[model samples]
Target: MLIDSGSPGAPATIGISLTINGEVRELQVAPWTTLLDLLREDLDLTGTKKGCDHGQCGACTVLVNGTRINSCLALAVMKDGAEIVTVEGLAKHAGQDGAMHPLQAAFVERDAFQCGYCTPGQLCSAAGMIAEGHATSREEIREAMSGNICRCGAYTNIVDAIEDVMHAGAAR
Candidate 1:
C-alpha cells in the first residue's frame, strides 16, 4: 500500500495505502480523492492522463488486478491493497532496461495519436483490452475503445496500432 500528500481541493485528508505496479506505497490523501488524483498528484505518476474527470472518458484508465478500469471514477480510499498498474508500470514491465512496450512501439510506428494527450490512456486500454481477449476485430477494438476519446481523431491509426500488437502477440 502507498500514500502521499493530499491535494488542496481534495476531500477529507487521511492516510492511504495501495499496491501500485509492484511496490507498496503509503500516503496522506483526502478521503474523497479519486485514484487518478492520488496517482498524478501524490505519487507523481503523471503518465495516466486526465482527459475527463468523469467516467465518460477512458483517459485515466489503469489496470486493477489485470482488469482495465477508469481511475478517475475510483476513490483512493477504495483501492486499499489493490494491485494497480499504470502506464508507467506497463512500460517498466515491458522491459527491464526501460524499453518501450510493444503496444507503445506499435503506436509510435502507426502514428496512432495526434496531440498525444490521449495516447497514454489509449495504450493502457489497448494493453488490457488485448489481454482480456476483447479485441477480436477492428470493429471489436473500436467498440472496446469507444470510451477513450481521441480528440485528435486518430481512431484509424489507433485501431491499426492495436491490431499490430494483437497480431504480433498471436504470432508469438
Candidate 2:
C-alpha cells in the first residue's frame, strides 16, 4: 500500500520490498525513483551503470525475475516484490576458491571488456540473454545483444565470449 505525503502532487513515498542480489531489502522511496537510482544511490550497489539514462543505451540493464530490463526506465515502486539480479548477483557461487559464473569467466578469457564502464550492464544483459535460450549461434548472440552498446569496440570479443559460454551450456 502506498501512503502519500500531505503535499498535493508529491510522488508517493512508500516502503517496498525487493529481492535484490539474492537478498531481501526494505526501502522507502518515492514512486518516481528509478530502479537504477534505488540500486546505485540508496543501496550502494554501483555495479549497474548509468549511461544515456533514457533507455537508449543498455548500460542500466538488470535482470528482473530472470528477464533483462532497463533499470533506468523502471520505477522502483512498480517493481516492489520483484526479484532483481544485478551484475554483482550474477555469480551465485564466487569467492577465493569458488568458481565464477561461466559468463564472467568467459568475459575475462575472451577479453570482452575495456574501460569496464559498460561491463556490469553487459554482463547482466548477457546472463539474461543466455537464460532466454534463443541465441544458438554467434550471429544470434550478436543480434540478441544488440541492445547493449559497448563503446570500446569489443563486440567481436563479447560475441566470442558469449559463444563460448553458450557452447559450454553453462548459462544457468
Candidate 3:
C-alpha cells in the first residue's frame, strides 16, 4: 500500500535542513521552491521583501554566509546546510533584546522610506552593502543600491541613512 502525500499532482517532498537567523530549521519542500518562498511561507520570515522575483530588483536580497544574494533566484534545496540571513535575522543579530540595527535606526531617523514597501529590502540591502565594504562614497552607495528600486523616490534620504551609519563606523 502506498500513502499519498498531500501534494496533488506533485512529486514527493524533499527534506532540507538549513541554518536561518541563527536557528536550525528542517522542512519538507518541493525541489523547485525558491529560498524566498521558504523564508516567507514556512519560516514566517517575511522581512525579506519580494519586489521583483526575477532578480531584477534587489528587494528579495538576503545574506548567504554573509554575502548578499537575491533569495528569489536561489533554490531552497540548494541552500541545504547553508547559513541564511534575512532582514529579520539581521535585526535579531544586531540587537540584544528589542533594539534595532544601526542602519535601521538611521533609516528611521532620516525617514528613508515613503510608502515603506521597499524599506525592508532597502534596509537589508544596505546592511549587506555596508558589511561588504562596497560603499566607499555616496556615489558608491547609490550605485551599490541601484538594484533596489524605491518607487517612492526616497533616494536622498536612503543615502543619508546609509551614510550616517558609514560615517559613524556602525556598519562594522
* Count of residue pairs whose backbone atoms collide, per candidate: 10, 0, 0
Model with the higher lDDT, candidate 2 or 3: 2
Angstrom error at residue 63, model 2: 0.5
lDDT of each: 0.83, 0.86, 0.83
| Span of 10 residues, lowest total lDDT, candidate 2 | 92-101
Local accuracy of candidate 3 as per-residue lDDT tens digits, 1-172: 0223457787877887898988998878787789998888777888888887999878888888878888999998888888887878776766535778888889999999889878878887888888888678999999999989889999999999999999998763
Q: Give lDDT for model 3.
A: 0.83
**lDDT tens string, model 2, 100-167?**
77888999999999888888888888888888988888888889999999899899999999889888
Flag regions of model 3 displaced more than 4 Å: 1-10
The pairs that clash in candidate 1 are 1-18, 1-25, 2-17, 2-18, 2-25, 2-26, 3-25, 3-26, 3-27, 4-27
lDDT of 1 at 12: 51
Which one wins on lDDT? Answer: 2
What is the per-residue lDDT of model 1 for residues 41-98, given as tens digits with 9 covering 90 to 100? 8789999988879988799999888788999999987887788889888876555357
Model 3 lDDT at residue 109: 98
lDDT of 2 at 46: 94
